[model samples]
Target: MNEPSTIEKGGAEFEGVKLLLCENPLPPIDETIEAASDELPRSNHYTEPYSAPLRDLLGDRIGVSTEHIHINAGSELIRFA
Candidate 1:
C-alpha cells in the first residue's frame, strides 16, 4: 500500500506548522548584529573543531577545565553522541 499524504495522515490540511518555542521572537541586539557582521569575512572558513574559545570562557565561568566541557550543535547531535 502507498503511504498517505501529510494532510491525509494528519486527518486535516495543515497550512503550516510553527514551533514558536524553538525560536526567539525578538530581534537580535546591536551587539549581536555587529558581531555576526564582523564574522562574515571568515564565513568561508570551517569553524575550529573544538570551539576552544567558547569552551575556555565557559570553563572559566564555571571553574572547570576545557577537558570537562562538551558542546554540541544541538540536541539532535547530542542524541547521536
Candidate 2:
C-alpha cells in the first residue's frame, strides 16, 4: 500500500487550498480472493458499485464530467473526460 505522504506536492509557492484526505485499506489476499469468488464468472464485465456516487460528488471539480465517469471492478483506474 502506498503512503498518503507520497502524493506529489504542488508548486513551491503554495497558495491556500482545501485538501481532502481519504484512506482505504485493502483486505488480505486470501480474503479478497474469497470475496471475489462469486464474481469470477462475470468479472470481465464487472464495474465498481460506488463509482456513480463518487462521480456525483466530484461533479466537475477535477475536470471530470459525470457522464464520462467509468469505474472497473477489478482495477483502480477511474476514467473521466
Candidate 3:
C-alpha cells in the first residue's frame, strides 16, 4: 500500500481514524498456501472457490455485496480526490 500523501496528513478531518500503510506485506506463496490450508474445512476434501468462501466469512462486515469486492494482484496505481 502507498503511504498517505501530504493531503492525507493527520488533521481535524481525519482525527480518530486509524490508517494502515504497507508497501508490500504479503507472505511468500508457500506460506500463504499453508495458511489457507488451515482455514479449509476438514470434513470436505473439496472447498468452495476463493471468492465464495471469503464472502461467506465477511458477509456483513463490509456492508457491500460480494460482487463489489475486488482482488488485485498488485498495488492500486490510481488515486482519487
Measured by lDDT, the strongest candidate is 1
User: How does residue 58 of candidate 3 score in lDDT?
Assistant: 68
**lDDT digits (tens) for residues 1-81 of candidate 3:** 544433444553432335468544555699888887897767365434344667755666878777665443344522344
Which 10 successive residues of model 1 have the least lDDT summed? 1-10
List ranges where model 3 is wrong by over 4 Å.
1-50, 72-81
- Expressed as tens digits, the lDDT of each residue in 2-55 for candidate 1 is 334336355875553433576875799999999999999989875565678989
Local distance difference test, each candidate: 0.72, 0.62, 0.55
The reply for model 2, stretches above 4 Å from the true place, is: 1-50, 75-81
Question: Candidates 1 and 2: which is better by lDDT?
Answer: 1
lDDT for model 1: 0.72
RMSD of each: 7.2, 12.1, 11.9
Best by TM-score: 1
Which portions of model 1 show Cα errors greater than 4 Å? 1-19, 72-81
TM-score per candidate, chains pooled: 0.52, 0.26, 0.26
Task: Itemize residue pairs with steric clashes in candidate 2.
Answer: none
Candidate 2 achieves a global lDDT of 0.62
Per-residue lDDT, model 1, residue 3, is 37
